[model samples]
Target: MSNVKDVIVKLTDVEKEFDGVKVVKKLNLEVRKGEFLTLLGPSGCGKTTTLRMIAGFSNVTSGEIELEGRNVADLKPNERDVNTVFQSYALFPHMNVEDNIAFGLVEKKVPKAEIKERVAEMIKLVQLEGLEKRRPAQMSGGQKQRVAIARALINRPKVLLLDEPLGALDLKLRKQMQLELKHLQQKLGITFIYVTHDQEEALTMSDRIAVMNDGVMEQIGTPDEVYNRPKTKFVAGFVGESNILESYVTQVDEDLLHISLESGKALLHAPGFKNEEMIYICVRPENLLLSETKKEHFSIRGRIVEHVFAGSVIKTVVELINGQKLRVARHPNEEEFEVGTYVYVYWHPKKAIIVHTVEEQIYNVIEGTTNRIYEQLGEKYSPSAREDSHDQ
Candidate 1:
C-alpha cells in the first residue's frame, strides 16, 4: 500500500472543455514524489490538454488539482510551483546558455552570487558544463533541449512538466536523451510529468503511464501493468503490437476462463470477466510461439504465407485452417520459414488477453486473401507440406 506522504500531486475528477467538446473527462490520478510520470497518447487524445491544465496554462473546466496538499486552481502559471519544458525548447536565441539558465533566477531577484552558483550547478547537472558560453543557435538539438531543461530546473520548482521535449531530435539522439533525462529525474527527486505520443519512450522512462484516447483516459498503471494487462481494447491496440483474436466465452469460474476460437478453444485466467458472452483475446507479438509440429490443447496449424525480416526479429504471418491470419515473432538466428511453409502455432493460455468486441470484416478479407495465395503456390513443392499443407 502507498501512503499519501509519497504523493506530490493529485487530481480528482479533473476535466477540461474547449468550445463544448470535453477534451478531458473525469480524470483521477496521483503522482508520487520524485517519480517520473508520463502522459502518453496519440494526437488529440487529451494527454497534452491534461498536462497543460496541471501546469496552469489551460484552465480546468471542472475538478481539483492539488500539489503538495494545496489547491492551485486559482494560481496563475508563473505563480504555481511548477516549470514546463516545451517541445520547441523556447530558448531566447539572443541569450547565451548561462544567461538563459540564469533568467529565472534573475526574475525571482535571487542575489547575483546565488544565481551564478545555481547556473553553474545546472550546467553540470545537465552535463553541459563547458557549453555555458554558447548561445542557443550554436548548440545541437540535444544540447539546446538540455539548456531548456536546465532553465526549467534552475528554479527548483516543486514539479516539472515536459511536453515532448525530445520530439525534434533524431532517433539516436532521442534515445540518448531519454536515458539522460530519466537519470536526471531520479537524481533530483523532483516530480516529473512528461507528455509524449511515443509508446516505447513512455514504457522506457515512466514510473507510471496514463494512456488516454479520444479525450478520455483508458488506463493508468506501471508500464508492466498497462503493457501486460490492458483494461480495454483501445489500450491493447495502442500500447504495443498485439494480435487480437475474436473468441466466445465457453466457461467461467473464478480466475480461470475458457474461450473458443475459430481454430480451437483455449483458456484465459483474467479475473474481471464473466457471464459467458462474446470476447476478444489479445496476445503479444513475442508471446506467440512458432512450431513445426502440432501439439495437444494449445495448437493451431497454418501455412506461412509471408516472412518479413525486421532488424532484431523475423515476423511470420500464418493463415490458420479457418482463414485467420496470426502473426508470430521469432529470433533472427532461428530457422527461417519460406513463403509457403506449413507450420504449427502455439501460445500459453496465460499469454492471451481476452477482449469483448468483434473485429471488422475487412480483417477477414485481408487474411483470406493471404491464405489463398499460399494455397495456390502448390503444397507438393515442399518435403514437409505433403501432410500439413493439403490438409487445410
Candidate 2:
C-alpha cells in the first residue's frame, strides 16, 4: 500500500463534455505515489476520456487535475510531468528501437553523450539490448510494447498514463505484460494510471481500481474491497461475476437482517434496514453453497437447471420458485449432481453484500415530494437513511 501522505496525482470534481453531452462527470480521485490505479469499466463509460483529460489530450469542461499539488488544467501534454502510452504501439515505423526510445531526449536537445547513455540504459531496462537496431516491423507485439513503455518512461515523468497499452497483444502476451508492467511500476516507484475495459486485467494489475459507469465514478477502492464489498449494484455487477437477488426486508435485528426471496428466505448480517423494504444483495459464486438438505433461515430451495464446466470450477445454475436463477461454483472434488436435482442454496451471513440499486437511488430523489418518494418504495423514511449516508 502506498502511504496516504504520498499523493502524487489528484483529480477534483473533474468534468468533461463533448459538444453538449457530458462524458466525464464530477470525478474526484487521489492517486498515491507508486500506486497502480486502474480506471475500469465498459466502453463509453468515459474511462478513456478521463485518461485523456489527465494526459492533456482531451480538455476538461470543469475540474482540477493536480500533479504534486500543482493544478494542470491548462498545461499541455509536453509541459506536464506526464506521458501516455496508447493501445496501438504508436512507434515511428522507419526508426530503430534506439532512436524511438531516445526521441524525447533528442527533441529536448540533450547532449549526444547523455542521450546515448540514457538510451542504452532504457534498452537494458526493457531487455532489448540486441534489438536496438531492429525496427518495429521486425519485432513481436510484446517487444514493441516494451519499446513504447520504455519511450514513455525515458523522461522520468511523475506519472504515466496508459490507455489500454496491452490491448493489441494476444491473451497470453497480454497476461504476461500485465505482470511485467506491474513489476516495472513497483520497481521504479512511478505512479501509474491505467485505463482498461477488462475486469480481470484491472484485478490483475491494479493496486486500486476506480469503477466508472455512464460518465460517473461508481466506486473506487482496493481490488479486494471493490470486489468483496461493493456499495452499489453497478460496481458489484461490473467488477466480477456476482449473484444478486431481488428481495424484500422481512426482519431487522441488532446486527442481522432477514430477507425474503420469492418462496425462500435468508438471514444476513446487514443491519439498519427497514422491514418490508425492497433491496438487492450480492454474493460471489464461490461463496454460494449448494446442499441436498435445506437449512432454516439460511437456505433457499432451488432446482439445478444446468451445469457449466469452466476448467477450474463447475458452475451449477439453480432456478428458484420465483424464476430467479443462482449459481454455485463446485470444486473439483465435489460431487456433480444431475441437471434436474433439487438443491438448497445458501452462504455464510457475512458474505452477502447489500448493494444499493434503483430502490436505494430513489430515496434521495424527490419527484413531487419526499413523502411521495418514500411511499413509493414502501419506506417510512426511517433512520436507516443515516446508515446509508455513510456509504455515500
Candidate 3:
C-alpha cells in the first residue's frame, strides 16, 4: 500500500446516466496529492465519462465528488481548480504559441507582467521556448500538444485532467510524449487524473490505475498490482495477455489446491477453494515455459501450433490435448520450436491465480461447480483478497 497522506480528489458512490441508460455506476475512487492516477479501459467502458465527472464537465446523477476536501459536484468546470487537456489540442488557429498559452491568464484578469512571466515559464517547462511565434499550422503534432499542455498548466490548477491527449499523435511521437508527460508531472508535483483506452499507456505512466468495465470499476491498484495480480477476470484479460484455463477443485491441503484440468490434474498454490469448486486459472504468457519433459506438480502436455517472432520475444501457441490453446512467450535468443512439435507447458504453482467461474460463458470451459467463497468467508474471500502463500 502507498502512504497516501492527503487525498486531492475523491469519488464516492458516483453514478451517471444518459436518457435513462446508466453509464457510470457506483464508482468509489481516491486520488492522492501529487500522484498520477489513470482511469483505463476500452471504448464505451466509461473512462471518459468518469474523467468528465471529475472535471465538472458532466453532472453526476447521484453521489458525491469532493475536491481538496470540498464538495465540487455543484461547482462549474471553471469554478473548480482543475484544467483539462483534450485529445484535439483545442488551441486557437489564429493565435501563436505564446498567445494561446497566455489566453487563460488573460481571461482571469491576471496582471500583464505576471502573465508574461508565467507564460514564458510554462513555455520553457513544456520545451516550447523556440516555438513561441509558431502558429498551430506551423508546429508539429508534438509541439501542438505541448502547447495544449502548457496552456492548461499555466494556471497551476490543483489537479490536471487529460482525456487521451496523445491520441492524435503518431505512434512514435505518442511514445515520446508519454515519458515527457511523466517527467513533467513529477517535476510539477501536480495531481494528474488521466483517461486512456490504451493499456500500454496506462502501464507505462501511471502511479496507479483504476480499470473499469461497463461503467463499473473492476480493480484499482499500482501498475504492478493491477498487471500482476488482477482481482477480476475482466482485468486479467484487458490489461495484458493471459492464458486462462478452466478447472475444478478436486482436493485441498492447506494452501495447495489440487485441480482437475481437461487434459490432466495439476497442483496450484492458492486459497479460498473448496472441494468440487469450479474456477479459472490465469497465467501470463511470459510465465509459461516450454520443456521437453513434464514436471511433477504444474505441467501439461501440448503440441506447438504456431510461433510468432516478436522483436524481443517469441510467442509460441500450443494446443493442449483438450483442444485448448495457450500462448507462451520466450526470449528471442532461446532455441525455437517448430509447429507440430510435442512439448510440455509448465509454470510454477505460485504463478497461477484462481478466479470465480461464472455463467454466460462460452470461451474455454463449462461451469462445473460453485463455492460460496465470498458468502462463507465474508470479506476474507473477496475478489480483492490475495493469498500470501508462495512455493517454498
Candidate 4:
C-alpha cells in the first residue's frame, strides 16, 4: 500500500553461470522499498538462482548487486541485510517454533531479554502465538512455513527473499497462504523479493512481476500489465491462456490496418500495422465472442469441436477451415454451442494484441535491443495505451 519509490535492491547487468553454462544473462532489476515483487517463471529459468545470488547463497558470475545502494557483491550471507525462506521450510527438526524463530538473534548474541521480546513480536507477526511449543515434526505444512518466515523476519532484514515457500501446501492452503503473505508484507513494510513458478500465485500477490525465461527477463510489470499487455509471445502464452494467430498485413487504411490469416482465409483489423508485414496476434480466450449471426468485421467461421462446462464459464474449442484451433471462454449464462455446430468467432480490434514472434524474440536476445516489431508499433499501440483508447 505504500507508494514510496525507494530502491531497496538493484541488480545491474547480472549474469550467473554454472560450469560454463549461463543461467542468468545480463539481468537488470530493481526492487522498490515496501513492494511485493515476484520473480515468476518456470523451473530452471534462473529465478531461484537470482534469489540465491541476492541472498548471498550463490555468487554472480558478472555484474553488481546493490542492497540499499551499497554494493553487496562481496558480502557474506550473514553480512548482507537480507534473509531467505526456502521451499523446504528449513526449520530445524530438533527446534521448537520459538527456538527456531530465535535462532538468528541467538547467533547474533543479542541479550536474552531483547531476544525474547523480538521472538514474541515475530510470533505475533506471523500469527503463530499459540504454536510456540510445537516442533517442525508436529506442525502442519502451513504452520511450519510460518515458522520459517518468522525465523527469517526475526532479523528485521531490509529485504526478505522467498523461494516457492508455499509450493508444498495443498491447493486450498496455498491459496489461503497467498493472501496472508501479501497482507503480512504490506503490514511489515518490508521489501519482499518472492520467487515462484505458479502464475496464479504471482498474479495474486505481486505488486509487480518480473517474468523470466531461459536466463533472460522476458517482461516486468504489474500483474494486469503482464497479463493484458504481454511484451513477447512467450509472456503471453506462459502467463495465461491465449489464442495466437499468425497473420500478414494485407491493407492499410490510415490508422487502421487490415490483416489476413497466413492462409488468407480470415481477415482481421488492427491499428498501426505495416502492409505486407507478418506478425503474431494474441487474443485471450475470454475476449473471443461467439455469435450465431456474423459480425460486421473480424468475424471467422469455425465449427465447434468440443464444449466443456467449467463451473463459472464454458470453454469451447473451435477449428477453422485451415485447421487452426482456437479455444473460447464464454460466460456460463451464454448459450452453449454443440459439437460440429457452426458459429461465428468475432472480437473487437482493440482486444487483439500484436506480440513478438519467436524469431523476433530470439533476435532481441541476441542483439540486446528492443524488438523492431515493437519499435514499429510504438507507444500508441501498447497494451495500456490501446486499453485507454478503447475506453475513450
Candidate 5:
C-alpha cells in the first residue's frame, strides 16, 4: 500500500451530471505521486467523464477535486497545473513537432532561448530526436502520439492526464508504445492518471487500476489484486476472463463457508458472509483444469462446446448442466480431446474468489423479499393489510 501523504491527486465524492442524468457518481479516489493510475472500464462507464472533470474540461457536480490538498474542482483548464492528452493526438497540422512541443512555453511568453532548450529536452525525453521537423501529416500514428505527449510534458504539470492516448495506434505499435510510456513515466517520476478500456493495456502500464462500471467505481487496487481478488462480479468479469458461479450460503462458521453449489454442497474457506446469502464466486480460466478422468475433491462434469487455439495457449469452453459456460486455458498439449466430449472441470478449493460486496441489497430489491428499503424510508411493508379488500 502507498502512503496516504504521498497522494498527489484526490477526488472526494466527486460527481458529474448532464441534463439531470448522473454519469459519474460520487467517486472517491487517491492517486499517489509518481505512480501510473489507470481508470479502466467499458464505454460510457464515466471513465472519460472522470478524466475530463479532473482536467477541468467538465465541472464537478458536487464534492471536491484536490491537487496537493487544494480543491481545484471549479478551476479553469488553464488555471489548473495539469495538462491533457487525447486519443486524437490533437496537434497543430501546420506546425512541426518542434513548434507543437514549444506551444505552451510560447503562450506563456517565456524567453525564446529557454523555450528552445526545454523543447529540445522534451523531444529527447519522448525520443523524437530527428523528427522535430515532421508535421502531424508527415508523421506516423506513433510519432504523432509522442509529439502530443511531448507537448503535454513540456509544461511539466504535476499530473498528466492521458485519455486513451494509444487508442489510435496499431496492435504492434500499441504494445511497443505501452512499454515506452511506462518507461517514460518511471524516468520522470510524475503522476500519471490514465484512462483506458483495454484491460491488458491497463495491466501492463498501470501501477494501480480503478475499475469502474455504470458510473460507479467497483474496485481499485494493484493489477494482481484487481485480477486475482476482485471485490465484485463486475470487476471479475471486466478485468479478465472469469467463470462466475452463483451459490447460496447455507451455513457459515468463522472463515469457513458451506455453500449449496448446483444441486450439491461444497465447502469454501473464504472469510466473511451471512447465511442464506446469494453470493458470486469466480475463478480464472488458467486456474480451472479440464480432465477426462475425475480424481478430485470437487469436480463438475461438463461438455466441451468450443476450443480456440491462439498460438501459445488453447482455450476450451465448457457448458455445464446448468447452462453456464466455463473456460479453461492452458498451454498446447498432445491431448486429443475433441469438441462435444465430456470432461470434468476442477480446481483447488482455495482457487475460488468469493466476491464480497453489498450486492445482497440488490438481490433483496430483485427478490422483493426484504423490508430494509421501507425501513430506511421510515415506513413498513404491510401487504397483508390490503390482502382482503378492506375486510378480514
Candidate 6:
C-alpha cells in the first residue's frame, strides 16, 4: 500500500515489564513502509511483548512509538491504524469468511456495497472464492489462516502485525504459507511485522530480522546478515549450527587475526578483532570440508565418530586430537565417511568467523563494527586462527 522508501513505523527505547520481571528491555527498531520485518526469537525473548507494544495491547514502560512521522505511543490500539493476525486465527465462530473479512470494515462504518466488494476481492485473493459462506470451524487450518490474513489486509491498515500466524499449521502447510505470505507482502506492498520462533519461517519471509534474547535485542539485520554475521556467541549458536571453538588471539594485523585453537594452530583472518584477547571461532558445519587424505594446506586430523544422514545433508562428527568434536555437513552425493574413519577437517580462511565474548562492551563493539565490515567485505567475514599443533 506504500513505498518502502518511507519510514512507516518507529519504536525507540521500548520496554515492558510484567510482575516485576522485565519482559522487554530497551529496544529500538524502524519498520520501513511496505517492508516485511519479522521479530524472531525463542519464547520469553520479548518478541510478543514488542508486538503488543506496537499494537497498544500493552503499555510502554518508557519510549516513543511513531507511525508515519506521528507519535502513537499515547494513542489507543484502534486509533493506531494497524491490524494484527493472531496465531489462534481469532475468527468469530458464528461468522462466515465474507462476514469475518467484512467485520473490520463494518466497524469502520463503510457502506454495505463497498464492504461486499472488498470481502469478495479478499476471498479471491486468498483463493477461497467458493468458501466465503463457510464458518471458521468448517474450514481447514490453512483456510482459516487465509481468512485471518484476508481480514487483516482488507482493512488497509498502515501496518499488519502477525504473531506466529502459521505456527498451528502442519509442516507442509507452514512452508506453503511462508511462501504465500512472502509473495503477498511483496504484491500488496504493505508493512508487515511478523513474529515467530520458527527460524526457517523468519528466514524465508522477512525483508529484515530482529533477533531478541533474554528480553533484549541481540542483532537486527537481513536474514542473511543475522545468519552469516552473528554478533555474539548466543547469536552465533542460536541462529544456526556452528562449531564454536574457543581460541586465544595470538596476533593481529590489517584484516587478519591469528589465533590458537585447541585442536592445533591454524591461520585465522577475522577482521573484527582489534584487541588480542581470547576469542571464539564460529565455523558453520557446511563450511567444514572432510577429506580422506591430508592436503598440503591447513587442516586438522580427526576421527569420524558418527555419520548421521539428515535428509538433505550428511552430518559427519569428528573428534580432533584434543578431544574436541567438530561437525561437518556435506552433500549426499559424496561417498559417506563411516564411523571410526580417520579424516582431515579443513575450511577456507573466509569460512571461519572470529567471535568475541558476550560481555556488554564487547557486544556493543561487535554490533557497531558489523555495518562497516559488511560495506568493506561485501558479506560476512571469513576468518581463520592459528594454533600450536594437532593433538589427536
lDDT of 6 by residue, 1-392 (tens): 23534888888888787888888888888889888999988897998888888998988888888888889867999998899999999999999888999999999899999998999998888889899899988999999999999999998988999999999999999999899989988999899999999887888899999888888887889989988888777778888889988877677767666666777655566765665577777999999888887754455778999888899998988999899998889888987877888888777778888665558545667756864664577433422211122221
Q: Per-residue lDDT for 1-392 in model 2, tens only?
A: 34647988888899998889998888999998888999999999998889888888888898888888888877999999999999898999999999999999999999999999999998888889899999999999999999999999999998999999999999999998999899999999999999999999999999999999999887889899999899789998988899889889888887788888875889888866688978889999999888898887865888999999899999889998778888788887897778899888888889898898644655535533654655566654533563587589
In model 6, how large is the Cα lDDT of residue 151?
A: 95
lDDT of 1 by residue, 213-327 (tens): 8777777899999999887777888898888887777778788777777877667677756556677778987888877876655556688898888989999888888998887
How many backbone overlaps does candidate 3 show?
A: 0
Pairs of residues clashing in candidate 3: none
Q: Could you tell me which 10 consecutive residues in candidate 3 have the lowest summed lDDT?
A: 362-371
Pairs that collide, model 2: none
Poorest 10 consecutive residues by lDDT, candidate 6: 383-392
What is the TM-score of each predicted model, taking all chains together?
Answer: 0.86, 0.90, 0.89, 0.89, 0.88, 0.88
After TM-score superposition, what is the CA distance of residue 281 in candidate 5 from its true location, in Å?
Answer: 0.7
Report every candidate's CA lDDT.
0.86, 0.88, 0.88, 0.88, 0.87, 0.84
Q: Name the candidate that leads on TM-score.
A: 2
* Backbone clash count, each prediction separately: 2, 0, 0, 0, 0, 14
lDDT value, residue 167 of candidate 2: 92
Among all windows of ten consecutive residues in candidate 4, which has the lowest summed lDDT? 262-271
Q: Candidate 1, residue 246: CA error in Å?
A: 1.2
Over 1-392, each residue of candidate 4 has an lDDT whose tens digit, in order, gives 22324888999999999999999999999889888999999999999999999999999999999998899978999999999999999889999999999999999999999999999999998899888899999999999999999999999998999999999999999999999999999999999999999999999999999999999998899999999999898899999899998878777877566777833333455665678988888999999887778766455778899888888988999998788899999888788777999888877777888899556867757644433444568977665565588798
lDDT per residue for candidate 5 within 1-392, as digits (tens), equals 55768988999999899999999988999999889999999999999999989898888999899988888956899988899999998999999999999999999999999999999999989889998888899989999999999999999999999999999999999999999999999999999999999999999999999999889998899999999999888888889999888888888888877777683355567875689988788989988877798743455778899989978989889898778888888788747578999887777768888874546535645646444443445533454333343585
